[model samples]
Target: MELPRHYNENRLVLMVQEPTIIFSYWELSRGQWESLGDERFLVLRLYTTGSNRVSTVLKEVSLPPFTNDWYFRNVLPEHTYHAELGYYGPEGEFYPLLRSNKVVTPRTRPVEGMVRFLKVKTVILDTTNKDTAEEQGDSNAFWGGYSSMDLVHRS
Candidate 1:
């Protein structure tokens, strides 16, 4: 069996690992990889959402041969970013191969009470235990440690 002469390998993906970190992955078809010839070097370009309005390049990275993935650090938090994978020619030109989806890094610090609410853990205790007085008090008790008096005032 013989493989097809041309394969559809145009794909680029971006992921956020942390507030200051991002990851990129790409694939190149056999033809696209070989067309570069001696200029087989690859590069990754980053663009901020704000800059995307004007189609600007925030940063550029030179990728090694056969490299299909990269980890970028020191990126700002709470900002949307995108990456472009391309080939670098000797004439100081970059031929774009694929563009990745936009990824937004999470904020480094959450607002007040936000962290507390997110950290709150809820546990469902078996309220059917007839031996416990607490369970006997309220069968419709919520997951939180809510007393009968608290429930009365809430209603």
Candidate 2:
């Protein structure tokens, strides 16, 4: 008995190995490989969870003859990401052939009492209006010169 030349399903499969590592596998039939006709490159694109707009090419592996597996490492944690299998070409061009399902990396909790700093900025409000004083001597902009209590009441 001999094995089949290719499986029925030609698809890309991705899995998470660790908080910062991913593994991928794919299968391409002889007909599909011939269609590419050399200059075949497999590119993996990573996207931030829930956002199609935010993404970057994580890795690109040149397909030589019959290679179809890759291990992606050093990924960010607590983010949803997906892999795109595609062909790479001239002038930074890539055409995606297939896409894997989204995979979310595991989250690690931070230690208790983590050191965090809060920044406070100081702002000064000039109660003395030089422009009003110069223009109108003693005329105020509001009935009581726009007090903070007025702002609070308006809100």
Candidate 3:
């Protein structure tokens, strides 16, 4: 089996592997590569979008111009993320060459105060059966009651 050198498209992809890490891959088409001048350094940037929908760069790695993939670690859980292939301009500017799909990281833990269901059994003790309970030598009789239920029907 053979794989083509590049996808021949200018696109990027970002995905979450678990709660704290994300991976990205990209391919720049011929035109996209030629469009980048030598004025700035190429970079792969990982961003996290906050609740206000503002994207903040989490990490930026210098690219070797032909680099295709990278991994971002120590990311915060439940954060929206995306990747951008761009140039770090001389005047504190970012020239985005291509953008990746957006995704949200999974939470690391269960939500607090969430409802949970558990199986339970109720047992009633018979205080009147203490002598029989003592004869059985069961530890449950320590409370001076048999570990048996006696239901009294209200009806």
RMSD of 2: 17.1
Model 2 regions more than 4 Å off: 1-5, 50-53, 63-65, 110-155
- Compose the digit string of candidate 2's lDDT tens values, residues 75-132: 8878787777777678778888778888888887764643433433333335664444
Q: Give the TM-score of candidate 1.
A: 0.62
Whole-model lDDT values for every prediction: 0.76, 0.69, 0.77
Minimum summed lDDT over a 10-residue window in model 2 is located at 116-125
> What tens digits encode model 3's per-residue C-alpha lDDT throughout 45-75?
8888888989998898997755788888999
RMSD of each: 10.2, 17.1, 16.6
lDDT of 1: 0.76
Q: TM-scores of all models?
A: 0.62, 0.57, 0.65
Q: Which residue pairs come into collision in candidate 1?
A: none
Q: Which one wins by lDDT: 2 or 3?
A: 3
Candidate 2's displacement at residue 45, Å, is: 3.3
Q: Per-residue lDDT of 1-155 in model 1, one digit per residue for the tens?
A: 99864455878899999999999888887777677677467789998886446556778998877677888889889888998988666687888888999998999885653122122333345656464434456544444455555656789
How many residue pairs clash in each candidate at the backbone level? Answer: 0, 0, 0
